[model samples]
Target: EGVAAFVASQGTLSYQLEHFVDSHDLLGRSVCSMGSSGSKYISSHEDSDSAQTHEGVTVVDAGTWVSEPALWVEWTHTGRLESVGETRIFVIDAERMFKALLHPGLRAVATQYAGEFHKRVVTAKPPLASYPSDIEVPHADFCGIVCCMAHPWRVQIGMHAFRKLAAAGGFGTGIAAHMKSRLKHEILTGRSVLVVSG
Candidate 1:
């Protein structure tokens, strides 16, 4: 969260806007370009000159895109097989898969319902509607992972499973956990990597 502080004065903002705006007549993103074209800059901080910026936006990647997260698995198979054939299944780590899916955020919520509630807060991943007073606020991203992975095995969370996982204070069903654990340790079939470059 960021705080907003407005300091208003007669003709101050308007006067600044005159220099700040272009033909669009709006204080726009062009100002960052202006700096590249020798525009003036002011800084309140003593060492602001050394700070680096790019294209007017800073270099920060959001953990989760401000959108719902989903994982989709698809494969193309060929009939040709070796004489001594084998079936290989590749499973990605739940934590790593979730980490990559949630590359931008660790505890990012999916926003089914966010904001303060009358009795408690309602921030959870992938749209859960409630929380206990003692447990940590859940993440919507994890819920998305569980839901997507749960689809393949048809492991619906029943009442007993729900109660058991809930009793342990985890946001997962037993089937979901079993599915995720299988995914986490399932062997991979990616081509060997020789060069690692960003």
Candidate 2:
């Protein structure tokens, strides 16, 4: 999602423009000519230095001109793929698909609505304007979501699922006990807990 947003913002174009301008030598030829001509117009006595610099710039500048177009084409393809992947993920996850389509800053409301939609008791669609108080707060953006999936609302949801699994003895007692405690800590502090797996 973040990559799609960044590419959509045209930041890649801005970066490429800056890179081109910095690498292009505006005075390379004339400066090099002055070295052999000993032109009075040129003030610097270091003819050898200027010629050497011009030679290097010519190689680098030519390479930049040749490579940049191909790189830009590659990046365009990459950005498109990223955007496509983001769209597909949203499509498969009905809840996130709905949330992504909602007005900016209303992600929490969208999530609440999707939850209601999934309820077995919901025979008809709920009103769009009203949502449960528990989900009134905004949810995290992409990076925040990656850093911690344990948003307060998500923690509650996980707790419910975990309890069901525990009752079914899906996990060993010690592992389940440890996870239960961790969930409690996350809810109490409203912070992410890292769980690394090999």
lDDT of 2 by residue, 32-112 (tens): 011111111111111121122232221111001111111111111111111211111111222234446666434653355
Model 1, 1-198: lDDT tens per residue? Answer: 111111111111110111211112211110011111112112221111222234332211211111111111111110111111222222233234434545332223212112111112223322344231111122333333333322222132223244454576655554577664443333121111111111
Candidate 2, lDDT over the whole model:
0.26
Q: What lDDT does each candidate get?
A: 0.22, 0.26
Model 1 per-residue lDDT at 111? 22
TM-score of each: 0.14, 0.23
Cα RMSD to native, each candidate?
A: 23.0, 22.2
In model 1, residue pairs whose N, Cα or C atoms come closer than 3 Å (at least 3 residues apart or on different chains), thus clashing, are 62-104, 63-104, 63-105, 90-187, 124-140, 125-139, 125-140, 126-140
Q: Please report how far candidate 2 places residue 148 from its true position, in Å.
A: 5.4
